[model samples]
Target chain A: MNDVIKLLTSHRSVRKFEARELPEGLLETLIKAGQAAATSSHIQAYSVIRVKNPSSLEKLVELTGGQPYVASCSEFLVFCADMKRPLEAAARTGEDVVSGMTEQLLVATVDVSLMAQNVVIAAESEGLGICYIGGIRNNPQAVSELLELPKHVYPVFGMCIGYPAHEPDIKPRLPVDAVLKVDSYRDDETQVAAFDSTMHAYYQSRKGGNKDANWSQNLTPLFNQKLRPHMRDFLIEKGFTMK
Target chain B: MNDVIKLLTSHRSVRKFEARELPEGLLETLIKAGQAAATSSHIQAYSVIRVKNPSSLEKLVELTGGQPYVASCSEFLVFCADMKRPLEAAARTGEDVVSGMTEQLLVATVDVSLMAQNVVIAAESEGLGICYIGGIRNNPQAVSELLELPKHVYPVFGMCIGYPAHEPDIKPRLPVDAVLKVDSYRDDETQVAAFDSTMHAYYQSRKGGNKDANWSQNLTPLFNQKLRPHMRDFLIEKGFTMK
Candidate 1:
């Protein structure tokens, strides 16, 4: 396989990082590569905030529910789905533009995601390790306040990038039968059951430490408890009114 | 620079494709590579439907506002943000799982976008061209019914991947200053103004033909009208009640 495919398939979320910082100008080049990813009609409905201040980094580490990688990584960035820029640009053109809509929220969200994935691939190509911090949503309000993010903008996720301190085994995934369906959706009971067995073995044999949970067993907490109930109200207040 | 970075920076959306099928097993390998991308909390809230039927391809071509590439490409796939699978799996394990919440919608949307971007990068690495069809949301209901998509499963976008018949110029993007900020958010008026001039020249001298418009000018119609207003009600009906 080519380097690109090989780099992609052997990917793992890197949490531990060496103390060394990224080489000069690498972060700039990585962000440029991210801008090359496709945007919806060139709207570029996204913005990234690089947290370089040590105090702000510590605050973010706390905001993300104690993910220390936020403080230790060579660089940490919060990717925000930003419709404000395009809306303001369109308004400057003297068109009667609206502020927020449900579709606008979706477009900005997807646009940011596509751009961020390119950033991930570019970082990986440069021999860097990365971890996505979805736990940012655990305290989106506090992070938003700390970042001074304005209206019509919301932080979707965060990323920690640095040189790897350790190489962890790539986690097992659901079989293709469970994800890639042909022509129509099908029940995945068989595929899901089989994957649980695979994951059960993976947890026990993984490098970090042994855990006794499988796929479905691990998902119990996420589903049983309310998962971040404040998100809807937070999005509305941020001008994602979902009209 | 490595081949991966070069390939990524030079990516262009190929509308015209050579009428040849992919090498055997290439598609499966590409999907596997896509699966390796990071998912939020292992929710893996996404599904891909391979659209091979000629009539459905033609219909999708029409559905995407006469984007003929949908019909002409060697392969077409619809990437859906699916919460149904995981929710059902959690339910079968005797957990009282809630179906539709605002956070659920956002997670699924981000999940599917990340997975689909990997698919795009994988396809491009193997010398294929790809275009994402956001117009699928224009008439999402009809398309969803045709694909037999159930509740909590909605198509985010469609992709056409194949060998390029023509290599178009890589369209210019907004400057990095406009997209990336440090410590806090900043207004991008200056960068946007500069980018508008850049896009003006790009539109006037492009390969296909000269067009009289810039970036902000082009966004007028999108913001001036209630773009995709039907999406709000459709998502609600499809079990993405962003409550």
Candidate 2:
């Protein structure tokens, strides 16, 4: 494989960091690389907030369900899906802007995600380890208020970037046959069953091995309960009414 | 910049492609690279459908707002946000799975976008070009029916990948100061106005210099109309009730 493809395939999330800040200009270079991702209709509907304050970082750690990496990492960034700029920009052209269509939410969310993925890849290429803190959404309102986000913008997720303090094995993904299909959707129950065994073995043989859970059991918490049920109302209050 | 960072920042969407097929195994390698992206709780809630049949390609071209490259590209992939697999796996463990919630929708959508971005980067690194066809959402119902997608699964976007038939200039993004913030949200009117001038010059000097528009003006159509108003109801029918 080529260097880029190799880097792409070797990704593993790093939650433990060495507490060393990045070089002065590297973060800006990474953000510029992020801006190069293709956006929907050229609507660059995303903004990233870099959190360097110790008190704010501590609050964010509590807000994100006690992910200490949020505070311990060299740099913490919250990626927000932002429509405020686009809406105002369009309004300047003398158009009666439609604000809360569901498609707007989808477009902005996807735009920010594509941009953030580019940032992740760029950071990894630079030898910085990173972790995506989806827990930011567990308390979206507090995160929004904390970042002083305006209307038509919401925090999608947060990312922690720094030098790695731990080396976790790359988690194996689902078999290629399970995710890829020809022309139509198909069930991959057999592949999934086989993968359960692989994951079970992985959990038992990793660096610290006292776990006895398979993939299916690991997914129980996410499915058995309503997750972030307030997201709909929060998004609506933030101007993505899903009309 | 290093080679990877240089590649990341030099991306351009290529709509015209040479009428040639990918080598036998390259597509799978690209998908493997895509699978390396991090997932929320390792849910891996996504799938990809590769459409090669001419009839299906024609139908997709129409479904995606007549993007002829859908049929002309060597490979056309439909990236799907899929909760069905994870939900079913969790249910098999004897937990009563909550079928749909707003967070589930967000997670699946974000998961698929990250994976697809990895695929895009891998393709570009291999001397291939790609274009993201967001038009797939224009008639999502028809596209889903064409792909026979099940409930709890929805197509997020389509991608056209192949050798480039023509090179296009990389489109400039908004000024960096406009998107990256420090600690708190801030308005970027000054930087945006400066970017307008940069884009205006770019539009005038580009190879085909007949177009006269700035970035703000280009976003008018997306906001002036209720674009894809059916998406909310469509997603609801697909079992993503945004609960």
Q: Candidate 1: list runs displaced more than 4 Å.
A: none
Number of the top candidate by TM-score? Answer: 2
Which residue runs does candidate 2 get wrong by more than 4 Å? none
Model 1 residue B67 CA deviation (Å) reads 1.4
Instruction: Provide the TM-score of chain A alone for each candidate, in the order shown.
Output: 0.98, 0.98
Candidate 2 local lDDT, B66-123, one digit each (tens): 8999999999999999999999999999989997798899999999999999999999
Give the Cα-based TM-score of candidate 1 against the true structure.
Answer: 0.98
What's the CA error at residue B196 for candidate 1, in Å?
0.5
Model 2 DockQ vs. reference: 0.91
Q: In order, what lDDT does every prediction score? A: 0.90, 0.94
Over the full model, what C-alpha lDDT does candidate 2 score relative to the true structure? 0.94
